[model samples]
Structures are given as C-alpha cells and as structure tokens.
Target chain A: MSQPVRASLWAGLYCPGLPLSAVWDHQPGIGPVAVHSHQRGQARIFQAGRIAAQHGVRAGMGLSQALALLPQLQSRPRNPAMEQRALEQIALAAYGHSHQVVLAPPDTVLLEIAGSQRLRGGLQPLLDQLVKTLRQQGFRVRCGTAVVPAAARLLARVGQHADSPERLQHTLDALPIDALGLAPGKQQAIIGCGLRRLGELVRMGAPERARRFGSALNAELDQLYGRQPTPLAGWQPPERYRQRLELPVPSERSEALLFAGNRALDHLGGWLEVRDRALTALHVTLEREDAGNPIALGLSLARPGFDRARLLEMLALKLDRIRLPAPVAALVLKAETTLEHRPPQADLWDGRNHGDAWPALLDRLRARLGEEALSGIAPQADHRPEHAWRWVPPGTTRVCTETRPRPTWLLPEPRPCQRADFRLEDGPERIEAGWWDGQDCRRDYWIARDGRNRRVWIFHEHEPRSGWFLHGLFC
Target chain B: MPEAQPLQHLLDQRSDLWRGRRRPQARCTGSGRAELDAWLPDGGWPCGRLVEILPACLGSGELDLLMPLLAEQTRQGQPVMLIAPPLVPCPQRLHRAGIALDRLVVVRAPDQALWAAEQSLKSGVCGSVLVWHPRGRVDARSIRRLQLAARESDAPAFVCYRRHQQPPPSLSALRLGLEPGPQLTLLRGDGPTRALHLGRANVIELAVRRRQSASAP
Candidate 1:
C-alpha cells in the first residue's frame, strides 16, 4: 500500500504601511498622511498611505520633494510607540485564530493554522473572518497561505497567493533575489550579475553562488523550501506591561501627564487581557526635564483589577495631588505588580460578588488622600489604656485576646471631672497593674450616667491623685 | 447527563454554595450578650443586610450592642470598618472586647462617610461597615441604595441615626432604637416591636459591694 503525504499549512498576515496606517487610524481623514523619519539629517518618508502614494509620494522619497509634488500631502513624524502598540494589537488578534503566532516585525504576523482548518470549517472562512476583523480594527491587511511559514510570509509580503507546496516552490523560484532580505551589497552583486530572479540564481554552481552572494541567500532559500527547518520563536505575551511615551510638547500641568498615562493604560488593559493577569499595583512615572527624580505616582489596589475606567479614575485622583517641580517631557506607565486573575465564581442564585467594587473605590480614596489617611487599629501588649493600643496600616493581622466588655471610646489622657449632676450607676472595679513601667497606675473604675443619660466610663486615681477623672465613653 | 443529575443533587445538598445569600441561618451569630441574643431574630443579629441603629444619645452603649458582631467578624478574619464614628475609638478597649484592632478601620471624613460606607460594604473586604450619619439628613433614597448595595455583598451594613429624628421613608432590613441603661427597642424588623434589656452585670458595682462588705468587719 502507498500512503499520500499531507502538507502543513501556515497563514501570514502583512500590513504594508503600518506606521502610516497607525497614524491614519488615530487621526483619520487628516488629508493623505505620510509618516516621515529623520535620516542623515534629512526627513525621509517611512510609510505612505494609498492616498499619499497615489499623489506621487513613496517611502525613501525626500520630504521636501514629496511636499513639492503634492501640496496636500500631510507629513507626520513616525511614532514608534504607536506602531509598536498596533503591532501588539495585531499579534493579539492573531492569537484568537491560532495557538502558535509568530510576530514578524515592521509588521507581519504568521500563524500555524494547519490543524485548525477543520475546526474552523476550512482555511478560507478563517482567513476571511480574520481579514474582516483586522480591517474593522483599522488595519489594511494582505493575507496569504502556503505550505511553509517562510513561503507564506514571502507570499504575503509580495501580495501573492499560494496554496500547495509545489505552487509555493514555483513562486519562490520566480521571486526576485531582493525578496530574501539579503544585505544591500549582496543583493546588488546578485542583481549586477544579470541574475534577476531566484530561479536563475539557483541554476548557477552552488560554490560560485556562495562565493559571490555569500551563504545567506542559500540559507534563506533552503528555509523557504523547507529543506531546512524554519523554527520561528512563537510570540509570547509579555510578563509585564511597560509603555514609555514622549509628549508632543513639554508641559508642566499634571493634567497633561494624566492624559498620556491614560493612553498607556489603554494598551496595558489589552496586554493584561492577552496575558490573563490582573494588575494589583501600577507605577506611573513622569519623566521631567532637568528634574531631581521622575515624579512617580503609584496606585495599590486592594483587590486585583483590570477595568480601565477604574484605573483611570484612580489615576485622576492621584494626578490631582502631584505638584510638578518641572515640565514633563515624557511619561512611563509600568504594571509594577500583577496576579494571575481568577474570575470570581458566580453564585448559583445571587450571581457574582458585586462586593469587589469597594476595592477600586478605596484605591481611589487612598490615591488622593495618601496612604497615611487610612489606618487600622491594632492592640499593643501594654496594660495602660493609651499605651495598650496603636494605629496600624489597614490589612495587618494581629491577635486579640477576649476579655470583659470594654468602652468603645478612650480619651488620650484622663480629664479631671466633677461628679455634679452625674449619677454613679456602677462603681469600684479596681485595677492595680502596670507597675513595671515606672508609670504605675492604681485606679478604681466606675460607670456613670450623665444628666442627659449618656453613659460615661470614669475612674478615680488612688493615693496621690484622689480626684475623679473621665477615662472613656461607651456608645 | 443522567448520572450527573444525582451527583449535582448531592453537591447542592452538601455544598456550602454561596448562591447569593440564603436566609439567616437558625444557628446565627450570637450577640455575645446572652440576654440580648435571646430577643434578637434568628437568635442573633441577621447577616448580609442593613440594620438601622437609632441611638437616643451619644455614649448610650450603642457600640457595646454591636461589639459581639464586630469581635466575631474580626476573629474570622473579616475586617470591621467604622465610618465617621461619633467619638474617637479607643483601640485598647476594642482589643479587650476581643475585636482585632488590626482588622478595625476607622474612616473619619464626616461628609464622605456614607459614600465610604457604601463602598466598604460593596468591597467585600470587610465583614461589616458601621456608618454614623450624625448631622446631615440622609434621605430614603440613599438608605435604599445602601440597602441594595449591602445585599450584593457578604458584609452586613449598619447605619446609625440619632434618635427622635424621624425615620427615613426608606426602610432598612432591621431597625433598633437604643435607649439609656443599654436597652434596645426594636423600631422595625420582620418581628414585632418590643424592648430588649441589654443590662449586663456591672463589674464595678459588684467589686465595690464586695469591698464594702469585707470592710464592715
């Protein structure tokens, strides 16, 4: 019996003009935009949209020449932060379609979808859905599928479609040697030899091709043909989310810092969802120009949080309290701490615990008022009423021993009092401890009712101090 | 699926499923004072609901009435928060009453007390929230909102209103009017209006009498 060999399938998604596309998505209908970058002290086009390209603008064209050709061409500086965020978003979208996703930078995403074809009903429908979703997310994508990952990426990059290994190989052979991304010197040498296509280069003697073009061309071809395994390090969601962004202009207003911080949080929320983690603490740093240290605003959540609205609300509160020493030129947002998020178990009848809302509110209050504003009461091991207790940070664990009923309120110091119009309801509970600390106290405690019938806890000092004093109140 | 039905039934029966909140259990938490617990519904203070406490005056043992609930909750690792308490809390006294001082949070902003209480109740981080609305007239709508918020979480909420101030139209799950001599009168609840004597033995009185008798010789 003879067995037929089955071909593995991979999908490649490429965005031709990602930098310009990201800017266009943010500032839509800004009349034919071109993303420009400084090269050798000259402004050069990094990416140009279809509209800009139609007006005779292209990548590598000098900005001055392009502007002269099309007066309506709106050139914007390339924002790497925005481009990176957009790429991460594309990778996240691909993750939903397949388990193994490889991020090819500047920008493309390759997904292993061979096994997922049957589950998704077939490759066409999956690709169709992916293209539709990516377009809806403000991206222009050219998708291609082939038998090998490298061939898929090459086909996608070149806007070619190949479904079978034989067809992919044929297309690869006919592809220009420049498609291999070889060094410019090697590519020029290969092209200068009158070998324009890969098929012509392959027909040459192997040693001759290596000695002239070097082994890079052969290595890329071998990987593309599956003669050598193309092991792509699959894109993994980052362990933490840290985004640094430069402001368009320096501003001393703290509110301006918050505006930039919010943009970072939007990306962070997406990243947290991708990584399946909840943020517990965040550090927002304002990079100041000529400053002592970066103004760091920290938010600590009582419970793990992911909601962006809540995060922004807390940030707004925190930002209001920061007094900027100098103008901030840039801002950085870091998820300083995170926890594996486990969604609260839904109750069969009561549904989910809405009690989690308080942590966010508490965090907001703490962010505005400072950590010292909130404290928990904890008991110390002293016998003196004032010395026996202390104020501790909330959430601390302390042991409390059971004793008799005690007053709810205690005075800082016992105030001298007259017994006039106050009826003594209970009397003479003697306490003789606390002699070891030199401030020995001997007192007889009593419960009294004031003229207004308010209950007060009073005590009389023994010996040297015979006067009655008010100690505490029971409410 | 057929085999799972019986398993599901057993799970439902034996499981401590927190499907929303069930009715107060028959073995509810005791009020620490035996005399007080006997008069209370479910043999103790109810859980997962708002209780309106109307004190005749400040320092009328209103805190003592809830001390047992506070102590029990803190012992179980559930925190207790007091929002805008009328008087400064003595941590030593609370610790002596078996309440963990570390588990007790006192929020002192009077204007934001109700908001803090509602947030704390909904936060589920605390076992109970004691909100003292001393000055402002809290409307029925606010009370209703608080009651609804309390029902969504496991923590019990207590709103303290001064006595003689007309009760808000919004009804809480339970209402008790505290009088002098540490007495509690049920203002409203599922049960009938009645008085409860929370009179415990005054250790001061007992000791004084004992000393006097011993000196008579």
Candidate 2:
C-alpha cells in the first residue's frame, strides 16, 4: 500500500482525560489557561478565572463557588468512564468517515486526510462538511491538521489552527510550549529557561535534551514530528441479538404486552442453542411512537450464561418498577456484552420449549416481590466476619468481586443469639478484617444448632461492643 | 426463462406448500380439527415464511385467533416465539386449545419486539415467531431479512401489528385482517366475535397497470 501523504484538514479532536471548556462566545483574545488541580495559586495569562468558566470555578473552588461564577451553566460530575465512552463512540463514528484513525493514550483521536486530498474536491468544501458534522453534535471542535498528531494537538490548543492556512509550520511554531500539554512543572521550567516555543525545543540535540529533560519529554517531541508512526488498533463491536415489536396503538398495560414478548424469548432461546453465544446483559428500549426518545434499560449479568427463562425471570423481577407513562408504540430488545462459552459436545438433540406453560408462575412471583426482594449471594472483597460475602440480585451469575473464604452461615442483621444460652451444637470460626477504612471488626462466629437442630452462623463482636448476631444458615 | 402458469394451475401446484389443498407439506399442516381446518384455507400458515396478523388494539381476542395454529405447531414439535407481544398468550387457554405447554419458550423484549422478531429469525431455530409492533414501520429491508432467516431455518415469522391498514408491497406470505365483526348471538353474550376479513392469503400475479399509456393516449 502507498504511504498516505500528510496534509491540512479540519479535525475535531479532544483528549478524554483533559478538562476543556468553551465559555459563552469564547474568543481567542487571551493567552493559555491551564486547568490545574491545585488551589490557592493562579498562573499568569489565565484567560478565564476558575470562578468564571462554567465548570472552572478555580481548581479547589467548591460547587457553590463554581455555580456562583456562572449561575446558568449546566453542571455534571467529571467521570473518566463517561468521557472515555464518549470519546470511543465519536472516534468509532469518525473512523467510518476516515479509514486511518489515530488514537492517543486515554482519550484522543486523529483522522488523517492527506490521501483523500485529490478526491476531496477542494479543501474549503471538505472543511465545511467536517465542520457541519462536528458542530451539529454540540461539540466545540478545534479543526486543524499537521503532518504529525502532536503538532495537530498543539495547533488545536492555539486558536491559529484553521482549514484555509496551508502554512502549518508557522502556525505550529507560533504555539507556546504550554499548548503541548507538558506537565505544569516542566512547562514552567522550560519557560523559565526561555524555551517557550516547540521550535525552540526541537532545535536541542537528542542527548542534551534527554540528559536535561527525561525520556518522556523527548518521546513526546519525537511523536510530534513525523519521525515516529502511531497507529490505533480499533476495537471490534460485540455481536448483538435483537428483536422488535410494533404496536397498532400505544399501550402501558403489562399483560396486554406479552403477546409479542413471549415470542421473542422463544426465538432467542433457540438461537442461543445453535451458536452458544453466552449472553449476560440485555439493553431493552421502549419507544413511545409519538415521542422520539426511547427509555433505555440496561440489565447486567452476574454470571456468564444463557437461559431465556432465567433472563426473563430476572427481568420480571425488575419490570414491576418500570412505569410506562404513555402508551408504547414500539419495543426493541438487544442482548449484548456477550462472552464465549460452549457446553460439552453432546448428541444432535433437537429441543424445544414453548411459552414455558407456566411462565406466569415466575411472572407472578416477580410482580408480587419487588425487584430487590429477591437476590442471590456472591462473595465480596473482604475476609471479615460480616464483609466476606454479599447478597446481590438473583440470576447474577457473574464472578463474585471478592475471593475471601466464607463461613457457611451468616446471620441476617446480627441478632443476640446468646452463646451461654446459644445452643453450642456447632463450633466457632474466628474472623478479622478491615486494615484500611478504620472501622475494623474481629469476631468469633459459631455455626450453632438450635434445639430443633437448625444450623445458624452466630457471631459476637469482640471489641467496641459485646453483642451476638445471627449471620446465616447452613442450608 | 421459467414459464409463467395461470392462477389456478399456480395455486394448484402451491397447494402442496400452501396447506389449503390436499397436497400440503406435513409441517405446514395445522389444526387436525376439521371445522377450523376448513375455515382456514391453508390449514394455518406456511411453515417457513411470514404471517401478518393485524389487530386494531390490544386484548381484542388477537391471541385467540392464533392460539389454534400455535397449538398445532407445538404438537408438531416445532419451536415458537411470541415476539415482544402486548400480552403473554394465556397458557391455560392454550392448553384448552390443545397446545403442548412444555414445548414453548417465551422471550420478553418489551419494545424492540421487531428487533426481537428479527433476532429470532436470524437464529433459524424456531418454527414460528409471533410479533406485535402495532404502529412500527416494517420496511422492505427488514421484511426481506426476516423472510431470508425463516427460509434458512425452515421456520416461519408472524407479525401482529396494531396497524390501521396494510402497507404496499406486503412482506407477508399470508396477511390476515381481524376486525370486531358481527357477533354470534348465543347465551354466551360475552363479546363480539371478531372475524378475520379482507385478507390477502397469497400474492398472485395481479396484473400490473401501465401508469402511462404505451402509445399516445
């Protein structure tokens, strides 16, 4: 394959882990503003004060302080997961538009368009299309392309990045060292030494630079130039199985709805048998025809398994709380986030299960028992007497988050099962936990049998209090 | 090029696949019951295609009309899917209709019932998929995929919609329109006996009219 020649383009790029903001009618009159994590200090040329920008209420500024800066500014907690997901989605979408997608660490994407130059008609027309797509999605996109991804990123930081100017070297050289997103202390050190420009840093010898600054500093520079090639190996989408239902009229009644749902589960079950794609989570969307937005419900799996009845049973446990305010017009179900698991090879057996003749038995139980009223127990991240295991929602077949050895019987809400009077039909198991969090507990737990020979795990807290609690039963 | 046969000859040959005629596929056979079998031209529905069942609203005896067929298919040992339907078909009532309760699997994909139907078809496992997407638009592409899936698995896909009227270029091999028709006045004056009327069981070579005259007017 021919190597793609680099050229200028309107690139909508962002660093997932970076904190960026666009103030109302944000103009490029001021200098660089570093969104730092520190408090009690301000950098020179700070364009927008922490108190001014929507979420920038100074690094250590409290929520009230930030709100006071801009009362109407919408606020949302900073979630690295949310940012990463959004970046991956946008990157995937942009990938379809451009074949060569450059993914940066944590969360940054680069689309190289040098090869598409001739077929792109003209630079302005291409820029217009790119701008339109990115702007429509409410993103404050910085469009620029350099021969290198780092150069593009730096140029993006400076307002000089644009589609029309073919002279990219000048634009890149004009951006300050701070635009490179170097660590703040390093940036200050470099600026103090009068090394303000990317050009100034590039002029230094490799050995001297490596000796003065660390390998990270020089690697970043090498990455900015065309000397190193960085490529992103895109992720393959998970295989999904889906079913749909359309209603003649809108409806909210639960019973009037299963006529179609039952059929979908039957289809899914049969499909699962042939391929054996172990399914765990299902995303069900209920679309109200008149309304464009659909309410999306995401179900997670506790175990890697596939059994339509168990899935429906788990779903039934949660469906009672679902309120369809308006009549539903359509139903879409997609089982996703799948894993690979195959049962031992068996004879070519043809099996069929119909509307589970008594599907209502489970449905009725689910309807009566509020979702959380039923659950299964899973091991948790503790070895303490009380924290060794936890009760999670039923049908959660996922591996337990913890791997602590658990005593069979745990009392529910530790009742005072008197040990002297506490039938010592069974022995005690000593336990301890909590090296961190400070609320540590040590206890002597006993699997004692009642006069009726019923087994119970009873524990007496050794410190802080003298109380006996019934933990659980052996069965 | 294949020779085109007249409607009678074509349907006569189709009797084997359509179930209405004596020469019907064993799998296509539905409702050994004589009265109901006679009422249904193709016995019930073809084993491997689409059956479009349109109802005006929910709880309108929609399930009652299809239960007989579902029961027959279950007896034949073919799997069935009730796509995300408005309500679960009554199993007890299905038992009353002579369907084997043990031979059924019910999936509940609340709103994406259409997607669920397509997914079931994609698996090529079930003999039938019963869906209810009342106002959903079943475009030509989705219908074609469903048809292809059913053919691959030798299973059938049935969609029950709350549609006011059927769209052009029907995706179904058999389309039935059930309306709250004239009631049978009996001592059991419970409700109107909704009847299936104005349906297209099969698409024959209905003559195509030239939109514009071939010659000048």
Candidate 3:
C-alpha cells in the first residue's frame, strides 16, 4: 500500500526567542549584562558601533568605539549546549502531540500533520492548537505551514516581518546563501558567478549546473526549491528507556524536583517491573536554562534492574548533595545500558502465610505502626523468648527452625511478683532455647483473654526471681 | 450484560480479581469476631471503602481492630500500604500473629506539611491504603478525588478521621469512631479501662474489649 502523503506544519515554538535570551542575561540582576565570551569572562557589547547597510550597528565592532554609539549595550558569554537541550525539550513536548516529530539541526523541529488533522477537527484547527498551546507555555512563536520543509522553515523565520507569499519570497531571496548552512566556499562560489538570488538559482537547469559545479549544488538547489523530494525525518523515536512527565511548570525547588522525579521514577520503575532488564546507566538531560547550554549529567546504577525508588532516591540525594550554580531550565531523564534481566523476587511460599494473605497484612502493620516498628519473629533453633524471636526485614521468607516451637508472646521483660492482667484458656505451653548459649530461658506461654474480652497470648519467663513479662500484643 | 446481583449483594460477596466472578466454594474468611462479622454480610466491613478513625489524637491501640487482619494478609504476597500511618509501628508485635514485615512499606508523612498523598493511591501500587489525615476542613471535591482514586485501583482504602470536627461528606464505604474503650474493672490494681466503640451506617457496636483481664485461679 502506498504511504499516505503528510502535509507538514511548523510552528516556531520558540516564540520570543530573542527576548528570552535578553531577559535571561539580566536574570540574576547581576552587573550590567552582555552575552559574549571573554578571555577573563568579562562581558562585551554586540554590534558595538559600526553602522551596517541596514542602519543598525554591525556586531563585533570594537567595544570602545561601540560605546560611543550605543552606550546601553551589554553582552555575556554565549551558551549553545543549553540552547540545544531546551529546543530538544520543546521538540519532545511537540512530539507528544504528533508521532512524526523530528528534531532539526541548530534549533529547528519538524512536525508532520498529515494524519493529526482529525485529532483537532481539521488541519487549521490542529495548527491553531499547536500554536495556542505552545504560546500558553510562554513561547512567542511565528508559525508557517507549507508542503516544503525549506519553505516552512523560511516562512516561520521570515513571517515575523512580512505576511504575503511574494513579500516572504523576497525575504528568502534577500538572505545570503550562507543561511543554508553550506560552506562559505559554496556561498562565495555562488556569488562569485553572479548568482545572487534563490529564485535565480532555481531558474538554472540541474543537468547544466551539475555539468559545471557537480550534483551537490544541483541537489541543494532542488532541496531548497522543493523540486525533488524534500523528506524530513519526523521526530526521532526515543529509545525504549526514557522517562516522561507532564507538570504545570519546570520547577527548581528541591522537594518539587523530588516529587517530579518520583513520578519519572515511577514510570521507569513500572517498566522495570515487567522486565528483567536493569538500568545500568542513566542520563538526566535538562533543556531549561537556554537550549544552547543544555545540561547533561549521569549516574551509574550499582546493579541491573535496580530498585526504581532507590534510584530516584539516589537522584534526589545527588541533587541535594550538589549545589546548583544556576537555576534549572528543564529536566529530562534517560536510562541506558540495560543488562541481563534478573528479577529479584520473593519465595513461592513463605513459612508464615498460614494459608492466608499474611504478607499483605504485615505491610499494613508497617504502614500503620511505622517501618521501624514493623517486624516479624522468625523462629530460630531456640526456645528462649529472646532466641525464638529474631528481628528480620519483612521481605525475607519466614524460616521455620526445628527447635522448641516459638511461643506467640513473651513478657516484654520478665517482671517479678504478679498474677497480673492475663488469662490462660489452657495450661502454659512451655519452651526453652539457648541452653548452649548459657543464657538459658524457660517460659510458659498461654493464649489468654483479658478482662475486656479481647484475646492475647502471654508467657511467663523463669528466672532467678521467676517473673512474668508482657512480650507481644496479639492483633 | 445480565445484572447478576444488586450493588449491595455484590458487596456481600467477594471475588478474586482474576476469576472475574465469585464461586460458591470460594473460602472467604469472615472477620471471625462473631456478631460484628454477622452484621456485615460479606463477613466484614465493606471491602472497597474508607474507614475514618478518630482517637484521642494521642492514644495508642487505635488500630487494634484492623491490625491483625492486615498482619494475616501481609504474610501472603499481596502487600498493604499505609500512606500516612501515624506511628512508626511495632513490627515485632505483628510477627507474633504470623504477620510478615519485610513486605511492608511505611511512608512517613508527618514531615511533609503539604501532605499530598493522593498521587500515591492513584498510582495503584498497593493492595490496601490507610491515609492518616490531620484535622482540616475539606470539601466534596477532594473527597471525591480520593474515593475515585481508590475505587479506580480496586484497592481498599481507609481515610482515618483523626479529629472531631463535623464529618465531611464522603463517598467512603464506612465511617468509624475509635474512642476510648469502656471503663476497666478493678482487678489486680485500680486503673482506668477503655474499649473500642465502632459505628457503621448508623449501626453501633460499643466498647468491644481488645483483651480480657487475667482470671483469678
């Protein structure tokens, strides 16, 4: 079957792109700001003073000279990695809307809308929504729709200054060939031969041009004019291991980050639950500061299929331990290097279930009493109350040791002199462990009801004084 | 679809999530507390609802009624989670009744002032949820969100009513008051006695003693 043709739509989601950069420079409200690099990290002004043909001072003029023309100008060091990451985040957000979203090199993204029309009632509505939603996210984007990728990009870029196709076409015509991102050699070659405009370049025959300049020039021209097929790789499908989230804002608070991180961990953890694959390497990519300065950091899991909660906890721990020099612009989580699937699991049958859902019961106890307070008495090879009772983390399979059968209750401590507040329905069930340890203990445990009509199992531990202790309360 | 039973009838019966239907031979353990279990046809309180518990806000053993059942179920694979259980809990005591503790995850929420535990229930990770909410006036919307979250997960949830302000209108299947038990009879020494009084749907059971005093030989 022939694949359906996709008429693409592009909304420059980076609305107010320049304004954002300008505002970010002043964010810390630090000394008069500029966004240019310096050997001493000193800020400089852009387009200092030399006038350009378009009536504005050209960038890179001498700072001393530029000060005479635009005295208020400020500049700071450029950040590109931050820029790319932010764009990628925006791209990912865009991808959530349509499957065929692709990231373009140098802050560009493509969204194929051939099939997403019905999702918004029609193509125009979809584009409108795509624009509106992004705008609500604080982006000031100029959007343009066209069947051609180059045309769409050119339109969104230039649509700000003009509206008509002919006017927009002139804007594209005025752009130097360098805007194409090709080498300067090609730009010089094009201009050197008197070829000044894209329209003029398109007028030439491909075969004639190829005969002189080779097919690379002809191909680029065809690609630019949409003469030959101009196919875009819609958004790249993320690897099987990725964490996603939808929050009101990209927050920077520590607790908020953990909350968001917990969600991401939950997502990643759920996937881990179904498979044996363990996340060995993880990368948290953030695109918030500015895409040009995207932040990428990583953590290596100690073992495969690591506990997700533990992993998230580690991230929060790591985040807490490290100082964030700058405010976070955005966050992304990437888990890599999955290894052999060893699913750490509980036993098929624990000695404690007693034909009931006892494991679940204990969980409630822990949740209620507190994790520190919740414990199980694993019967050891001993009859002594202390030996019969061993504190074990609940996940361990209950082991039944063939010694004196452990009594259900022990005196919290064997206290002397009391035929106290416990009733015995039957004779005491005796137990004695720890003979080898020399701290021998003998106890008579009984299942008794208190005066209030509640059941409790208690025991008397024999000592030099022969005492009674309230060990455990039966639920 | 045939309406096999009314909603109340359905509540009177329990079925394994996997079977999709209840069988006559399915062995269901009634609460085993006699008259109280008889009041609940399913042999206990409603399975998929919240039981608001209110104590002295400082007293102990408020959970004496529900603790054992929780211990018994946790010994098996299905784990129960208490979202904001008030106490750190004494697991050694639970183990005495054959309850397993390793599977229990007690999340401390006392420190978190905002206390947004709603998301935990929505995630559907636990077999049962116990939320200890501090005293605050709440509206119907928050209550609905919590109820919807628990119902959606099919996880039985209990929101313990901690204070004595007017009970907020709720979709909770059961509402319980756990005050002091009845006066203790003077035995070995004179001391105050307390009992657990339980009420559900206007039906009341008062001062059920959790433990009897020692008998004089």
How high is the CA lDDT of each candidate model? 0.75, 0.52, 0.51
- Tens-place lDDT per residue, model 1, A1-475, is 7786666788889987788766555433457778899999999988887788888898999999999988888888887778876887788777777888898777888998887787668888998888887776667799988788988888888878777878887888889888877779878888999988888888898788788877777787788887888978998767767877666457887566666666667567657776767888888788888866988888888888676777888888777777778888777888855566756554578674545644665686677667766777776776556576676777676665526445778776889998775688887787777777667778888888777777788888884478888888876
Q: Which stretches of candidate 2 lie over 4 Å from their true place?
A: A1-12, A15-86, A95-102, A105-107, A112-140, A159-167, A183-222, A228-475, B1-217
Predicted candidate 2 versus true structure: per-residue lDDT over A1-475, tens digit per residue:
9885554453536532233332211112322232333334432212233334434544555545545655643333343443454454445545545656655544456676655555458544654565565454324455566666666665545534544333655565566787888788888878887888877887889888888777778777766664565444644322456656554345776554553455445545534543456666667788876796787765555444555665665555455557777777766778863547743332355553333322332333334333343333444456664554454543233333332223222443566666665576545666777758786778886656554444445777886567887665432
Who wins the lDDT comparison? 1
Candidate 3 docking class:
incorrect
Between prediction 1 and prediction 2, which has the larger TM-score?
Answer: 1
What is the alpha-carbon interface RMSD for each candidate?
Answer: 3.1, 19.4, 8.2
Expressed as tens digits, the lDDT of each residue in B34-152 for candidate 2 is 44444444554566777665544343345555555666577677556665554333322344444455455454444545555665665555556777764555566666666676665
Model 1 C-alpha lDDT per residue in residues B1-217, reported as the tens digit of each score: 8999997677567535555555434324566666666677667766668888888887777787787778778877777888878667876566655576766788767776777777777666677889888585667777888888887667768888865666686656678888866888887865546787666553333335445755997
* Cα DockQ of the candidate 1 complex: 0.34
Q: Candidate 1 at B11: error in angstroms? A: 34
Q: Tell me, by DockQ, which candidate is best.
A: 1
lDDT-wise, the better of 1 and 3 is: 1
Docking class of 2: incorrect
